[model samples]
Structures are given as C-alpha cells and as structure tokens.
Target: MTVRSAWLLPGGTDSPGQTREDTRLAPVGTMLPDGELGTRPGVIPGGDPFAATGAGAMSLQVATGRAQVQGTAAQGAYPVCLDAPEVVTFADGDAQFDRIDTVCLHVYDALFDTAGQNLAAVEVIVGSATDTPTAPTLDPACLPLWDVRVPAGASAGVGGIDWTSALTDRRRYTAAVGGIVPRGALSDVGAYDGQYADVEGLLYRWSTADDEWQLYRAPELPVETITDGADTATGWTLNSFDARRHGRVVQILGYWVRSGETLTTNPNIADTLIATLPTGWRPVVLVEAIASNGYGFGAVAIGTDGKLTVRSWAGGEKANALEKDTNVRVAATFVQ
Candidate 1:
C-alpha cells in the first residue's frame, strides 16, 4: 500500500480514504501539514477545537498543552486556558488588546464608602494562590486634582473628606490657614467654656462657665502711634505710651516724664491722657506706679462708657497733674 493509504484520515468510516489530489491531510492524532488544527485557517495549535464562532473563529481548548499565537495582528490576542484551577498568565510587557469594545471583569475584596461609593479606582492585591504579580503601593505625589483621603481623627465620622460641602455650601472656617473644624456652639458649663471659634470671620467665644457664645473682640484695636506730636525745635521732651495686644486684652506699658520745666502756653498738654482709646476698649486695671518724683502713685480706670484715664503720682495720694521732671512709670491692662 502507498504511504497515503496507510494513514487514518479525520473523515468518518462513511467517507473515502485520502486521495492523491488532496494535499492537506488531517487525522485524529496528527498535526496538520501547516501546523494548525482549528476551524479557521492558521488559528490554533495542538489537537482538538473548543468552540466555533459565527465568524468561523474556533476557540482552542487544551487538554494538557498550550496554544500560543505570536503575531501583531488582531486575531493573535487569544486567551490561553489550562485545566482545573490553573491560571494562564500573559507574558510581560504590553500585550495589546486590539479593538476591544466592552470588558467586564470580576474584582475581589474591594472597598466602599458609607454612601455606597467605590473608594478606589483599582486595587492591587499582594499575593494569590495561583498568581504572584507585583502589587502597587500608594504615592502622595501622584494625587489627582480632587483626591479624597480619610483623616485619622474625630473628623472622620462622615465618608472621608467633605468634598460636597466644599463644592456647594462652603464655609469660611473650612478654608482657614491654620486649618478649621465645623462650627460648634459654646457649652453652658464644660471644660471648653472659654474656648473660641470663628464662623465666617465672625469671632465668638464663651464668656463664663454658664454663658452662651458672645462676640470675642471682633473689631481689633487700631494701631495708634502715641507720640506727643511735638517739634524738636521747641526743646520739649516727648512722653512714650506703648500698647500691645495679647488675645482678648491689651497691655499698655510706658513711662511718663512730668517735665517740670516752666510752661509757655501749656506746651501741647503733657501727661493728660494724650491718646484716644477705641470706642469699645478701655483700661480695666492699673498696677501701682514705680514712683520717681512728686508724692507719686499710679491710677488707671475705665469709665462706664469706655474711656481711658491714666494717672501717676509720687510721695503720697495725689492727682495726676505733672510738674517739670516729676516722672512716673505705669503699667495697665485694657479690654475690648
């Protein structure tokens, strides 16, 4: 018998043997002459075909072998599967999926927020039973324009950062330089009784243990230069009164010289409260003066309508009227 007749061809017993005119011989357990064995031409490798497509493209399923296609064409992007819990990993580098319309994948162990929103775009798993692909880690420098992160404090009650409140009904405290918290009402009697808060630039703080919120010195005291406004040519010495702010109070500390020199028409009013205190601010306490001349003592008081009166005396109880060189030093506190 000839070599073609000795072979068992793929057609059934009702079909004839391989004829001499037929150049392509396909058998049950042999490779095709061009090394492919699927429904379409130049498609699969190994033995049997898996499933047929309407476009005549057949899937190659392996019982114990792999069917790899290595080409740049669109038909070369076929997935290889193994038997029973075996994972088929693609080769490294960009294995392009050409002209794919829709892709549906199943992700495991994803995270979500309280409002049922996905927390991450893609999650990286470290290790799996079948595959050990390198997982990715987080990097802060690569954040998007509007990325959300969960802070690790009392403010994390809601779903992460408040992006919606910042977009819609924004508040001034939410954008403060030193950072801010939500506006909280002053407690009646608590540990935070004297604490302060800023609501849209309106300052408010607790007064006492049992008090509600009150405006905590809103309009700051204007910085005033307390000079005698005297000319150097007149040979008249100038007095100094320096004021500085410390929280809700102001501390005025300076020295006043009772320039005892003889007067030429009052010489621009010496040591008689030569400054205008702001409307709602006045001295609340005046410490004792460190006497220098005259029978001195120091006195500072605030009128009921917010007026600042500063005085100094020496050698006993006396009025604040100054005589030449009868200097007196004073320290006082004021509040708004």
Candidate 2:
C-alpha cells in the first residue's frame, strides 16, 4: 500500500492559473491508526478521554486577574474543570458560577456588629442584595411599655398607689404616679383593701365582681332594715325602712304599726334597734313618730353618752300617751 501526505494551500481556485488538483484534499482521518478508526475502542473521537479511555493529568494555575468560563458536568461530583464567569479570584474570596441558575446560602446565629455592639442597637438595615434580609419597624404604642412576668414557682404582685409593703418580707416599688389607671368595673372598700394613692382628680380600683380594674367614685348608701329587736307581735310590725348617707348627713325613713298594747319609754331603744346608724351619731330629739289618727304620738331624745330614749307623749304635754291600733311614721336625720 502507498501512503501520501497532502497539504491544501489557501486562495486556490479552479479559474485562472489554479489547477483542479490543488482544490482537492484528502481527510485527516485517512492517516489515522487502524485501532483509532470508526466508533470502536481506541478510536480518536469515539471514547471520552476522561472516561473509558482513562483521563489525562491536568494542572491549573491562576496567578492574577480572573478567568470567565461556562459549562456543566455530572450531577453528584465536582467536575475536573469548573465553568466560571469573567471575574473569579479564589484568593480574594471572589467566585462566580455561570451554569447555576440560582444559589442559596443559609446562616445560623449570624452576627453583624460594629465596635463589638449588636447590630440591633445600631442602624437598622431594611434590605439585602446577596442574602435577601429584611427588617420591619415596630410601633411602641401598640405594645406595653413594660411587662411584669411571674416566673415559674414564684409569685409577684404590684402595690397600689401609696401602698406600702411590709417592712420585713415584701419588696416595694413606689411610683410617683399612683397605681395604674384601671379600666372597667370598680371595687368598694374592704377589710383587706389597701389605701389608694392620692390622684389630683381621679380614682381607680379593682372590681371583684366584674373581674376587671375600673375608675371609681363614692357610691350611694343602701337602705338597710333593723333586723334585730324589731317589733313582731300580733298586728304590730315594722315595715321597710331606708337609710342613706350623703356627705355629712345620714337619713332614715320608715313606718310601724301597732294594734296590741300601749308603747313604753326606753332610753336605749334607738341605739339597740337601729344598728345602721353611723358611728359617733346619737339620735338627738330627732325621732318623731305620729300615728295616722290624731290620738297617738311618740318622741325620741338622745342622752349625753350618745344613747337614745323613746317615749310616748300626748297633745296636752303629757308623756307615754301612745295607744293601741296606731300606725306611726318615723323620720330622722343625723350629722355624721
């Protein structure tokens, strides 16, 4: 067999002085080795150099600047030659990935600080370019300025305005502004209730029934009946009576009916029967009970010891003239 190596020269054309033989050139594969032909083993363009035919040694050195590249390889492992972008300097911590469509980076307990102080104390950043961070401003009025937390297995309570803690066992904090301005229902004074701090023109308390704190004011007194030592004989009864205190005066109004025996005088009757009277106030000639008929009349007088005496009197300046079958209305007022 004869072998020939043919080289084609450029700018050759069949026209003018160019020959036809110059335009004709043999393929480079015609000179390839027999084992490298076709798609069989050891073929030049068939098998991959890094795979079935065994990979060749490759060493890369990046001195300065950057090299841009792009490509893809197997899924699980890193490729021998990574496709990169135009500017990539590993020493300067700069990297670019051309083939990756998206990249995600996650950080745990990431700290950003200036002069060793937390970033939260410094300027609040709103947006981020690489990590996509975000921050939202909060409204202080929408939340409590301070919250008191009762730790587990511990108890905590806030004292009212001017409320003093026990000297030995309690911790106290005095607020210049009295207690909290309660909202909702109000509570009345009780045996265990503490004194409220003086507000210039406001009052507040806790309503045990309503289960909420509320603004409060002085309440009206309720009508209470004289339950004990009341006359309950046949046809003799004391009807409903109302008693109330307003500012410095206490008032009582009621009616009683008697049909059996004539009434007698007793100095301690008012003190014993009317337990609703406020302290330090004795019935002073204050009680006057007159019957519906013009025949019966009664009177009450207070002694120096704040005790009262009840006596029946007549129209002729006679005393103890109270007769049977008489209905008398009694009304009196006292300074408290």
Candidate 3:
C-alpha cells in the first residue's frame, strides 16, 4: 500500500502499514483546515517558548520552545523543538556602523537539505552595516525569534551590548486551525491584521494601522454616581446624580431639590447654574434637554464647561423664576 493509504486505514493483516513520513504528516493535517493546507505557521504558545535573553556581551540565549512550520508549495508541516537553551553569538560590530541581526529557528528536512537530516536549528542572519540598518531577510522554513541591534564599536568587555535595550522581540504565535485566537496568543505582527481575538469574553480585532487591539463592540464605561455634597449645587440637595459613557456618548441624570436660596422672577434664568458635571462627562457643544420642575416643564442646558444651567420655563411659569423648596429633574444625553 502507498504511504498515504498506509495511514488512512486501520491495520488489518498486512493490509496497511504506517511509515515515519505518515506520522509526521498527522500534525500538519490536524493543524490546517480543508482547502488551506499550508498557510499558517507559528510557535505554539506556552511556557514562554523560545524566549530570548541576554547571555553575555555579544551573545543571546533562546529558551526551550516548540513551533511548527509549513513547507513551501504546501508540501508538508514540520514540528520543531528546542529542548534546552541555546546561545547564539555575533561577530564584533563594524568600526563605525551599527547593524541588526535576526535570530531565527530554521527547520531542515531531508527533502530540502543536502545532508538529508530532518531537524530544526537556531540560526542568525547577519544584516548590513549602516547608519540605519534593518533586519535581514528570512527563509521560508525559518521563524524569526528576535532582532538584536549591535551598535558601533560594541565589543565583549568594557564597551559591550546593553542587554536591556538591544533586543526587540519578534516572536509571533498562532492558534489551532479553525479556532479564534485568545488574548494570550495575540501578536503585534502587522501581517496578521484583521484577525480576531477573544479577550475576557469580548471580541477584539487587530488594527494594523494603529498597531493595537481594538474592541469589536462599543465600550461601555461604568456608571459613576455623584453623592458628595461638594459636587452638589449650593442650597440644592441631590436626590440622584450620576453620569455614564458609552463610546462617544455622554449621559447625565440628576434630581435635586432647592433647600435654601431661591431665584426671584425678576432676573433672567436662561443661564442659571443648577449643578456641575465632572470633567469626563462634559460635552463639546451645549446640550439642551427638557427638565421638570415641581410645578411645570422647563429646559436645561449642559455646556462645554460642564455646568447644567436652567434655560427656560413653560406652562404659565415665568422663564426667570425658580421656586424655593422645589425639586428639579434634569437629564441630558450628548456626544462628547
């Protein structure tokens, strides 16, 4: 029986026999979806796999890790692993120039390697030396682990590489085939833009332009209530005052009673201050909403300065009048 057929059926009296190549193909088949044979390649996220660290002046160490690679032309999927930390060193820096070197995990198969050894190894691609250098090109069978920046005149002893600021992590992770990527597996790689992630039961999309994860739905801020007397208007006791935000919308609800000084019907009350909203609850433009006094209906305006002002009154009530010991209800919704 053929190698593919050998693994396709259950063993039955010499009818089929599985080979090593068939066993290797099992993971690849399981990881790729139908009609998408060899498209995705990435590290399996867990235990800080393949994390890079500074070993010395010009050397960096890679921790034990596991990853998968899809060969070109969708030929096969190969699983790679590093059982122990491996240190990779670099040449001394150029006299007057800096360069970026890429550390990668390269997978070699008998089909592609002249030596015919199917294995994975750590390798570095040296970059060009210049004032402004970039990472080197990577082979299809390789996964970049990190980018190390070697400044000019850097050496092993006195003037050496600064471990803290020299390493730029470039590792990208992938999830199982036909699954939504979790928050822990999210990558900053721009190539994965438009990918979706499940973060704490909320869906987020990767935005390449912004280089960040954006919420798929509008964010709802927590409702904040104002109960302190310091935030209440003078002579006005708050019954209920609160503010909440959802996306670009700001809403405020307040019910207050005038307990002390009351305005007379002589002066204008078009801009009389009722209460002040907190900073984040303020609106860009004036927001006018219908308010209810104990006697009749009136209008209140929320301004950019966060002040809630009485605008007008109706139903035989004078516009310039505010009754004493009466309750006022104001609610306004506006875009920030």
Candidate 4:
C-alpha cells in the first residue's frame, strides 16, 4: 500500500479545517505513528530530511503536503526529522506495502506555544531540498535575496542563499532599487514562503511550464517592495534569493486582515465544510522573534483540546471569538 501523498493532521476529525470523514490513503509509510520517519534514522545527511543530529530537540510539525515546520523546545536526546525528499520503505511490515513516494512533507509543531490560546509568534523552518535528498541537488524554489561577491566560501541554503549566521548581516541585501521598504531593525521579509518565517509577509506559489519554481504573492498580500537596500541586507546576512531574484531583494508585505484578524484567503485545513472554520478565523500568525532579538517569525497558539483561540492583528486589531473544545490550529499551509 504505497502512498502517493502524505498529510499530517495534528488533531483528530473534530479538529478545525479538517472534515469528520477525512481519511485519504497516503503514499507508503504515510500513516506512520510517531517513533521515527526519516530515511536513515541514525545517519545525518547534509540536505533536508537530514540526519536528525541536533542535540537540542524541539517539537516539530508540518501539515501534510505543506512545507512549513513548527517546533517547541524539547529536553531529551533530540531526534530531529528532516524534510524528507521522499519516503522509501516503511521498515515495519505491519504497514502492508514497503516503499512509498511523497509529493509533499507537511509537519506540525505545538510545543512552541503551550498556552495555545495566546501564542504571539513562531519560528517556521522550511527546507528547499529537492524530491531526492540522498544525493542533493540545488532546487531554487524560493531563493533568498542576497548579493553577489558573497562571502568567500559562503554557501546557499534553500532557494539558493546563505542564512547560516548567528546574526544575518543586512549590508549585502539590495532591493529592487525603489519602493516602500518594510519596517523594523533587520527584518527578513519573504515572498512565496521561504524556509524561515522571520517577517510579516505571504508566499504565494506558482510553477513555470518547465516546472521551474515560480513564486506569486500570497493572495492576501497584494502589495510588495524591494528598494535598493542590498547593502543594508548584506549587513543582515540576507542571502538566498540569488538563485531566483539574482541579488534583487523582493519583500512581501501588507496582508489583508479580514474581520480585523483572520486571513481572507488561505486553504482550509480540511476539504469539507465539517472541518472548515468561519470566514474570520486565523489559527497562526507570522510574527518576529523580538524575544530572541533579530527577526524570525513569531507564532500564535491553539490548545491541544477543549480550548478557544483567535489571531491578534497588527496595529492592535481585535479578533473574533473562536469556538472552544474544537481548537483546530489552522495555518494556510494545508496542501490537500
């Protein structure tokens, strides 16, 4: 019973954005119950689905088919999970078939916001590795914006930019020459949902006829900009879009806040109305990590069970009341 697609439902059928009768056959090794789900559970790879080699563990999750990863601090022998390029064998025979191919890998993380009801921001790490991660290839799906003459020996992360820095220097970052730049002290505004969520923005996706990764602005965010600020960006270590933007820093900003809080356009977690939430309800928020200094996406929270939630709009916008008990943490990353 090999699967063609895989999904990660954080909550059961009762969860928001998920229908009561939501049961789809995923690729082989699709419905694996926790434990371990990496290509080599022990050997860490350089690319995505990399060897879960991090000593410090964080609870990570992504919606089925979605590329976003959510996490919380975990105290133990950390067992990291990589953005697996594809799934091979289930290892366990009880799962029926052996190998399965995955079109997308969506994970979910709830530990970051225990309060569930009031999570201000979160850090979402997305991988740009290709469908085959074993022997990695450079897939510039959402290249980060960076300058040329990049630091000697400096390599690129997902989408083709280098972000391996304690403090990203914004000096190297240059915008499209003229436009309204974003606010904040070193914010990394992304377009088409990058590997990391550090600024308030949207990541609409598109593909060229040739299958090249062509990104569109999130429907909610209609306006964007990237003035001549690469030098300021380089100072922040802003580099990743080179593969796509070719040194032009494109910024995603101005998302339409519906009902003063929730988003106006994003896929529901579930296909049916049963799992659908009201028009004005946003499960998570894209915020900056003020506590951690620098600019990283902040997160919002929805409790495990028996709770209520709502998103707090920027400029101190109030949110609508969410029904309790059926707390469904609905982010716009659901791919089904």
Candidate 5:
C-alpha cells in the first residue's frame, strides 16, 4: 500500500481516488491525536458480541461482533467487524494428554506482510498437548477472545467437550475515548495507573503501587437516626441525634435537654449512660470528647461496647452536676 500524505487536511477537496486505506486512516488519526493510542484493544461493550459457544464435535461458534485494535502507527488502527456468526473447528484432543487452545481475532495488513493482502479473520490457534497445558502465544496483531480446554481422550460422544465448564470467556471491553471504563471490563488492575472505573455507581481509581482499585472519592455513608434510650429514661428529651461512618471513622451528632431531676452531689453522675450505638457502628476503643452540659462543658466517652457515657462537667460552680431543664450538645468522632 502506498503511504498517502495530505489526505485529511482541512478544506481539502474530495477526490474519487479515495481508497479503503483513506477511510480507515481517518478514525485512526482522530483517536491517535488525543493520546488514545494507550487505550487497550477490546470489543465494544453490549449485545453479547463475539460470544463463543460449543458447536458439536470439535467445533466452536462465535457470535457476530465488532472490536477496536490499535495496530502499529504505520498499519493504522483496525475496526474489525464480523458480519455473521463464524464457526471455528479445532483438532481433536490428544489421546493421552489434555491441551489448551485460544480463539483470537487476527488482523492481516499488507503493510507488514510480504503478500499484499489485507484481511481480518477469526482463527483458532491450537496449543501443544501436555500434562500441564497452557494457552498459545499470540501475534501482536491478534486479540484473544476465549480459551478452550480439551480434556484427555475427549471426543464427540460421551466424553465430548463439556461446553458448560470447559470454555472460559476472555472477552474484555474498551471505553469510548476519555470515558471511564466499566469495572467488569478491567482485566488488569495495574495496567494503567490512575485509570478510573465505574464500579456499581461508585468511582474507583487503579492504584498500581497497591495493585488494587482504590475509591476515587469519599464514599457516601447512610446517616442513621440514633434511637433514644438510657438518656431519655432519665427525663432527657433528645432534640436531634444522628450518626454516620466514612471508612474507619464514625461521627456522632446529638442534642438533648435535661428536663427531669439532675444529680448535684452524686460522685457517680459522670458514669451516666446516654445511649448505645449499633454493633457495627461502635468504636474500636474508648474515645472521649468535650460537649456542652447545661451551663458548663462536660466530657463524653464512647466505649467498645457501644455505650455513650457522660464523664464529668467543668467550667461551672457545681463540679460534677447537670442542672435540670438545661440543654446539652454532643459531637464526637472516632475510629471504628
């Protein structure tokens, strides 16, 4: 194929001499300009495209499909399409040893070949028979779609291939240029550092250092209404009580009024149980925070048993007392 220049120039006049290479180079040029060459080759997402199914005997059938491949810049990109379902047959299994084979889409370009024939076809690349069989190596122009395991002495009858479990779907998908990849299409978590994927409505970023997908944003945790219990039993009316967790941190927000009798001289008044957090919401260890108690500031502690206890009051004439009919506020944050 002759390399053409000045093909996609702006304000260029149309010519009847345009060939298939001209049309193919247009999209490839568009994708290349935006650093999209780094985008992995894959099938377009939906319609169960290119699904492989067992077809009797030693044959396997592939559904109609479409895929994108980033071949060398000299060869340009390939938008491969299968107009109709194609059946691929494999050689029968070895009589005494199991083998593995790979189904792949192979791209043939005249630019890189001695024969000036350009074509794209689906081919089954057979593997070597071995006690521990492995899939075959693919050419740079080939994209794998599935792996088939042929058991020892397997054939068309009672010991034929078990279509149910012998086939492994190796299909993966690529996103539109600059779009977030779907989590299901991520075959290598560490392939692209900082790549983002949408996982169940949440965004996750690939972390190559950790070899994992880390949450890209702060997670939205459900705010739970704190049920009034021990504090209410002592004539304390809760105004607003809520709790929420973000990762390992749990935060509490609450307000209440001591409307009933308040102990003025009781030394044990600091051990007042206000409420209990739910099992999973409790802190890992005792955590304390300062809160407003009547006319003074008081210490509040949350224990591992989920108990919220009032420690003691300061900044008031009454050392450890809670005046009646006074308002109190509680706001604490701790690691669970």
Candidate 6:
C-alpha cells in the first residue's frame, strides 16, 4: 500500500447521510407532450384519461422518481401543476429547499403557430408565488425566455425562478416558483392566463384538514430538482454535478482531472480545487469519497516483487523523495 492507499482505505463510512444535492431544480414548460417530462393532469385513479378537461390540459404521473406530465396540441395559455411532495416523498422526504431552483422552460416547438415567421423573444412571470402582479410583462434579461423557438407544431411550456414552492410545510411548503409560459403568445395566440397551464403543475396541494398532502391540478403554481455530479469516466459531457469522478477518491468536490503513471499529484488537491472555484459554485468533480457510498471501486500502486509494499509518497505532501533528502520529496519518478 502506498501513501494513496493509506488514506484511501476509508475513514469508515461518512456517517449515514443524505445529500440534498442542492434542493433546487430549474422549472421548464413546453406545449408538446413528447419530451418535456412532467405529471400531466386528470389521469384517472388507474392511469386512465379523465372524461372532463380544462385549458392547456394534459396527463400527469410519477415515473421512476419523477413527477412527469405530458401535454397536447390544443393547449391554451395555462400553467402546469407539479406535485413536488409526492414526487419528492419517493426520495428523501426530509430534503428542504428555501429558494426556487433554476427554472427549466420549454415552449415545445408544436405550440408555435409561426408558419414561416421568426420569433423575437419570450416572457415569463413569477405569478401567485409572490405578491407581484400576475404575468407581469417581464423583460428578456430578467426572464429566461429568450431565443426559445416554439417550432411550428409543438406546445409551449416555460420555466425559470418563480418562488411558489416554498410554502410552510403542513409544516413547510416546498419552495415553489411561479409560471414558465410564452411571451404574449407572440401573435394572435392565447393570452397568458396567469393560471396553471397544465394540470401537473398543481399536483400537490396542501390539505388543511388532514394536515398532510392532497391532490389537485388547479391552474396556478410551483419547484425542486437534484442531479448526479459523480463522474462516470464513460465520457459524458460532464456536468458540474456528476455523482462520482472516474475512480479516484479525489473528485469529491467536482473538478476535471487526469493522472500519469510516474507523475505526482497533491493529496490535498481537493482543498486546492475548492480554493480556485468561484464563491457559491463548485467544480464538476465527484467521487466515491466513502465506502458503501457508491461502486466501491479502487486503485493501488503495485511493486515488482508481487507484494503490495507500501511506499512513501512525498510527491505532493512533503518533498520529491522521502527516501532521499527530507526536504526533497513527492515526485515518484517511476512506478514498478
């Protein structure tokens, strides 16, 4: 075992913990029911279509841990509902979010009636969530609705920071963001109802009677989201939140890295990486920091003698070579 294996052995599991992984998720809306995943409204108790319907209506359900909703073609300007608690309950119910996550807006290409016309811009409003006016004609920079092209035949769904999910539970409400709709419908299109566009957006309503969760897709408000930051090494366009970093125990904070056979690296590289990043932003490095945490994978420095001999790695800890001058440690020079 070399110096790397010594500390890599495990400091015991990192205490049974739950990572909120950042409780915010960007809210997104779109007109088409195809790609944008959300729980659509009015699905029967058995996942059947309801006889009744409403404007900009669609289907909604919880799948593989996401509250997914689907949209349709005849959609009018309506807000989509999301049942955060139910979807969230599937994961860690204790996860709490104080502010709205980044909103994920989508105006499905189908929602646009622009035959051959070009789009100028889109608008968004943090309706109902705040005392602010409903569907306030927000500016472009302020709204995340710029360049959002609603293809000739797709539905529209907008997303961004709305601030409606943070209601106090029977104890606190999930921090909910407002609407993610279109900009003036862009033409003689529908007017922004400032109401819930899809039934899915109103999935989880607070029950004052039982003091728990209930279901309702009222046209109105909501938002929370999490993502894996670990590295897969399989070469996916690494996002800043990978759950693991390849195999090294060094990616706990999220940064890009590579290694060489006879080269050197700092054991405290994590601290250094964190020091270099901006204030609230973390590097895109993730690792199986503690055992029982992930794939339980590892690496070792082997010796030619076939014995796992532990050598001193002064590579970055001390000097260039621990066996030579005490001041000249670190760099391994070569490996057996």
After superposition, candidate 4 runs with Cα above 4 Å error: 1-107, 114-336
CA shift at 298, candidate 6, in angstroms? 71
Instruction: Give each model's clash number.
Output: 15, 3, 0, 69, 0, 95
Best by TM-score: 5
lDDT of 4 by residue, 1-336 (tens): 211122233242233222122333222222111123312111121222221121111112221111212122241111222223222111121112211112222222244323232111112222223332221121111111111111222222212212232112111111121211222112322222222211235322223243332333434533333322221111122221111121222222111111222222132211111121222221233322111111112223222221112322221121222222221222322100
lDDT string for model 1 (230-328, tens) is 221122233665666655475555555644342222322233442344443454543332333345453544443443344433333333334456545
Best first by TM-score, ranked: 5, 3, 2, 1, 6, 4
Using all chains and alpha carbons, the TM-scores for the candidates as numbered come to: 0.23, 0.24, 0.50, 0.13, 0.54, 0.14
For residues 50-144, could you state the per-residue lDDT of candidate 6 as single tens digits? 11111121111122111112234343222322222111110111122211111112222223443122111111122222222122232211212
Report the lDDT tens digits of candidate 3 across residue range 226-300: 443326667687888766677668667788887866655444444567788877768999889778876676788
Indicate whether candidate 2 or candidate 6 has the larger lDDT.
Answer: 2
Cα RMSD, model 4: 31.1
lDDT of 5 by residue, 80-134 (tens): 7665677776767788899888888766665686534455657778788899999
In terms of TM-score, which candidate is stronger, 3 or 4?
Answer: 3
Q: Which of candidates 1 and 5 is the stronger one according to lDDT?
A: 5
TM-score of 4: 0.13
Task: Predict model 6's lDDT versus the native.
Answer: 0.22
User: Cα deviation of 224 in candidate 6 (Å)?
Assistant: 53
Displacement of residue 59 (Cα, Å) in model 1 is 65
- lDDT (Cα atoms) of all candidates against the true structure: 0.29, 0.27, 0.66, 0.21, 0.67, 0.22
Which model, 3 or 4, shows the larger lDDT? 3
